[model samples]
Target: MPPPFPSRAEIEADQLEQLRALVTELFPANAFYTRKLEDCGVTFDVASLADFSRRFPFTTKAELVADQAAHPPFGSNLTYPLAAYTRFHQTSGTTGAPLRWLDTPESWAWLRELWTRVFTAAGVTAADRVCFAFSFGPFLGFWMAFESAQQLGCLCLPTGGMSSAARLRLLLDNGVTTLCCTPTYALRLGEVAREEGLDLGRSRVRRILVAGEPGGSLPAVRARIESLWPDARVRDHHGMTEVGPVTYECPAQPGVLHVMESGHYAEVIAPATGQPVSPGETGELVLTPLGRVASPVLRYRTGDLVRPAAVRAACVCGTHELALAGGILGRTDDMVIVRGVNVHPAAVEEILRAAGGVAEYQVTVTTRGPLAELALAIEPAADAGDATALARKIGGALETALGLRIPVHTVAAGSLPRFELKARRWHRAGK
Candidate 1:
């Protein structure tokens, strides 16, 4: 049987012990960590969280990438021999070159446990049928999610190698009660449902757990998906190939995601200063994997920007930790400045979804002279008015939401690309 999910306090205490043990185990064996820990005068036996925090230096993707390049295949971060690892996976390469990640059997089980929390939080039960809408690949798309369903005793339905229409058929035919996919793909599936004239709202699915993008928490995006699947509830989750599923949405709180600090240590720091920021302040998310021993990361900076809030009010779900206010507002890298105003693609997506005339949209940033401009190409609804009228509505909505004027251009339906994975909605011309 799987271990019962521990409370935040319990997880923290357990992690503290694990941290000390891992430090000792890796210190002499792994040169990368040995140098990192030794430089900070941190020994393997830390007695408190504060002591551990002070001992470990911040880990960055750039450093990991550099190490991988220096030592091909697996980086020098490995504490044990390469033969000890039983599983291999890689990053999505959405940000850069995919960094290969390996895990021992024990660590792989921990990954499943993290995902099990995801399923449980989304109200997944043994009686339910869970369908994964992912192309089985090295990117860790839904491989763990599939394994998690089995761990939870749920019937797993693999949608790999099937078309959207076929997946829809399987979903309806199998009475699937839950779905796991990227937020982009959920919307894409909705689009496919409309094309096939299938009433998705009436489908048997009761819940959807989405990750890989901020669309799950965007009001308009969430609203649109809920509108299409009336009986289904949409929940957001956050994870990375290097870090397992470390945060998930609680049904009690609609849009907020609770970070599982028991199995991980999470911190929000000013992106520029690298200093800890107060609660409710937007900052870069830095994570430490407390349970993933095979390739544990300490203070790894995740480019995701989030505002963390202290858990004061008791939640309906019981487990307590920090919660992200709006579930990954946007990535620090994805933020753009247009006409002296900051814009996140999610902000634009929220406005477009609320306006209701857009079928699809793309935001492009280009430099003309010394000024940066924001231009949008949108596919208007079938019954919507002319392109100019739709454009005006979009511009007004954006202005109201962002306090900035943006140009919206109506484009032919299907002109802009649709995404099944991460949606590259915003393009920055010339790097």
Candidate 2:
């Protein structure tokens, strides 16, 4: 049997030991880190986590992209031979170019184990029938989740090529107990179910594990999902194709996410200055996976902004893992300055999700004028009568919350794009 959960001190010590082991194993074999560490004049025998953080250089997506370009295809980060790798995936490329990632059997198993912990935290059991509603492409999330659920002896159902309607039928027919999907997709599926006259609240689905987007943590979004499927509880999760599963929502706390300290070492720092933020302050989340030595990223900058829980001891979850108060707030680059007001997509989504009756929406950042401004185009649901009134209500909510008057327009039904994975509703249209 596995050991009990370690305390914070034990977790830190384990992290330090793993850090040393990874460094010892990487140097002289991994060309990427050999050059980086040598250039920084650092050695493997680091004393403490603080020293390691101070001495070790950060790895960024830009650096990884350039490295791949310089070295061609796989890059020089691989410690093992190419033949040993069993998995290949890529980033969503929502911000910039997509990043290709690879994993060997060992590394892949490590990620699967992390997902197991995520499932355990969310109270998923072997008796639960889990259905993954996603396109089983190069994206690593659902693939890991699907495989992990299988390993847990769950009746894993994959709805890859099926349409939204077909997937809903399968879900209801099979009495799927757990649903794994993005929050946006969850809302979309609920909308589709409503249109089809299918009552999901009567279905056996009791838990929803949402990731690949920040919508799960937003109170309005979570409430909206729960309202749509009255019997289901939405649980937020955060991770990346590069870093593996980082955090899972605390079962006791609705909005808080506990870090998976068993496989990750996390830090929150100011995105601009690269300095550590206060306990309760918001900052970019930096991650270092303890396992994944085959394609390791030491002190990798994740670009995700989060606020750490003010008091870890206050948590009723019993584990001492660091908790993120509201999960991931938004990406660092997702913030926009519209007429002197700093607005984030998450904040806008919060208001929009809270103001029900809207089907889908898109935001266009207009830079043709003297300053940047936001224009919202919303697609009203069939039940949302009087498009003009819905638009006015959403506009008032946005104005009250953001302190900026963003123009809201109603577009034709089914005009805006729907997302199955990560939602990309914000568009920059203009030079």
Among all candidates shown, the one with the greatest TM-score:
2
**Consecutive 10-residue window with the lowest summed lDDT within model 2:** 1-10
Per-model TM values vs. the true structure? 0.94, 0.97
Against the true structure, candidate 1 reaches a TM-score of 0.94
lDDT of 1 by residue, 1-431 (tens): 74354665676687788777766677688877887778877666777877766656889888888989988978888878889998889987888888998888888898888889888888889999999999888867478889989988999999888898999989988899998888778877887888898888668999988998888988888888887777988989989987888788967788888887767878788999888888878999988887676788888889889988754344566656778888988888888777778888888888888888777888888876767778888887665778898899888999898888877888887788887678887776753
Angstrom error of the Cα, residue 259, model 1: value is 0.7
Supply the global lDDT for candidate 2.
0.90
Q: Which stretches of candidate 2 lie over 4 Å from their true place?
A: 1-4, 368-370
Clash totals in order: 0, 0
